[model samples]
Target: MMRHLRSIMRITWVDKVPSKEVLERTGLPSMEDLLTRKNLRWTGHLMRMSPNRLPNKSIYSQMPSVHRKRGRPRLRFKDTIKRNQKLRDIKTHSLASLSQQRDKWREIVK
Candidate 1:
């Protein structure tokens, strides 16, 4: 989308697009905004789950599945989030409460 928007900007402005300038400078909403919004929404979804709802809860926990024969076990949500994010705690109970604060969780996800 950034590339396409840059292309259109260049064409419409007769080939004078700013180099490495932000989308906001052009008065446009940005991909980063969209992604962060989506992440916040997903974080909210995870935070609002109950253990009885297996799928959402299972995202931060291991699930039973067929084993692979090779390099490593398949990646799951818990593995990815834990590797990239730092938190005071990642246990299921704490995750739910911490994620209740939208801005805080957004920063962690980002």
Candidate 2:
């Protein structure tokens, strides 16, 4: 994407233009920011789902005990959500109540 953007603007790496400047010039959000926003939006959708729904239930489900491989444990969906929230400096404690209010959550996401 950076390469594409640079090409569109006729910028070469030799020009030593920073990627941040390129993104700003193109009026686009950084890839990380875009992903974080999507994650937050999905989390809000899950939070607003009916408790009996499968997607919502899966979020709160506990994994059963099992044998582990000789490597670092994989990150769960819950962990990813927490990481995204942390990146945005959002308070988890208030997320439940805040997410229920669509307008407020939309503002925060922006």
Candidate 3:
């Protein structure tokens, strides 16, 4: 339908970058105007080298969570005890060997 086609065309135009003349006419300064002289030069250099536009918000939101909050149950005393036990085991096996190796190296150097 004509209405559907017109809506699609309007959405396409929304993604277009505005021109410098339009920015001036709107009384909106460029990113360079807000940054210091050094930062402006650095920004210009980076923009010239890699002139790619940034990703949309929807793209950012789709990224995997690096950290999760599982709430109070995960941070309880039982969980702390389990974590401490694991740390103790690591220190007894791996860290103890590393400490002995460091002491041996120090004795050899001395």
Candidate 4:
């Protein structure tokens, strides 16, 4: 992504332009930040859904007790959301309440 940005700006590595300067010059955010914001926004949407809805249930549902042979458990969507929330310094306990307010949630996610 940085490569594409640099190309668009007609910059080369030889110019020694830092990625941060490129992003600032283009008035854009980093790819990771964009993804994190999108995920958190979607999570807020899910939080506003009815509890019985499939998407909402899937996120808050309890998993059955079953042992796995895995050395590391696969990351789930919920885990990803939690990580994103932490990155943004959002409190987990307030997620549901905050998300219920669409305008507020949008501001917080940004």
Candidate 5:
């Protein structure tokens, strides 16, 4: 989306400023920011859910051992959470602690 937005700007003779600058000027959050917020929101939702509410706990907590046909395996959603946690430097392991604290989680997500 960022690339496409930049191309649109270029075609409009507005390439002098960076894509981020244009997005800011238009009061829109970048794609990355939107994805990050969504990821965090989903995490919060999952954390609040009971074992019965979640379709299958194994999806997030376990990976079946199997050999791939042959190619780079895609990163899983669980891996993405870990990567985001590391990137954000979240120390708490039990993110569920914030299930009842909306403001705190929002701050952490940001």
Candidate 6:
């Protein structure tokens, strides 16, 4: 008599998913078809390059001075005083009276 055997395989992250262009170049069927095939296998994760870390001393040394300008300076208007004076000279009126007159004219037209 004989007995059946089973085996397991480990996949690494370097094996990436196939792109559409690669599938087209290889003359393979749709991705769905490839995934459904009995022999098709894939690794679940992707590999990425490690990020570069700066030294603590360098990061602290590059701190901006508290007194120095951090960004673009604001625009200063020389005629601000004159502009405010002109604004103050303009007559103030109630907006409610203007709306009432407009409604009266519309009612007369209709």
CA lDDT of every candidate: 0.59, 0.92, 0.38, 0.90, 0.72, 0.30
Task: Indicate whether candidate 3 or candidate 4 has the larger TM-score.
Answer: 4
lDDT of the structure predicted as candidate 3: 0.38
Higher-scoring candidate on lDDT, 3 or 6: 3
lDDT of 2 by residue, 1-110 (tens): 99999999999999999999999999999999888899899999999999999999999999899998999999999999999888877799999898999999998787
Q: Which runs of model 1 end up more than 4 angstroms from their true locations?
A: 11-37, 64-66, 87-94, 102-110
Highest-scoring model, TM-score: 2
Give the clash total for candidate 1: 0
Order the candidates by TM-score, highest first: 2, 4, 5, 1, 3, 6
Candidate closer to the true structure by TM-score (higher is better), 5 or 6: 5
User: Measured by TM-score, how close is model 3 to the native structure?
Assistant: 0.18
Candidate 3 C-alpha error for residue 72, in Å: 47
lDDT of 4 by residue, 35-59 (tens): 9989988998898899899998888
Q: Per-prediction TM-score, please?
A: 0.50, 0.93, 0.18, 0.87, 0.71, 0.15
- Per-residue lDDT of model 5, residues 37-74, tens digit only: 78877877777677666543854566568787778889
Query: Candidates 1 and 4: which is better by lDDT?
Result: 4
- Give the C-alpha miss distance for residue 69 in model 1, angstroms: 3.6
Minimal lDDT window, size 10, model 4: 61-70
User: Comparing 3 and 5 by TM-score, which wins?
Assistant: 5
Which portions of model 3 show Cα errors greater than 4 Å? 1-18, 37-110
- Worst 10-residue lDDT window, candidate 1: 81-90
Best by lDDT: 2
Distance from true position, residue 98, model 5, in Å? Answer: 2.8
lDDT of 3 by residue, 1-110 (tens): 32344354453345553445445545655544433333323322332342254422322244465686676534533343334435333342443233345454233222
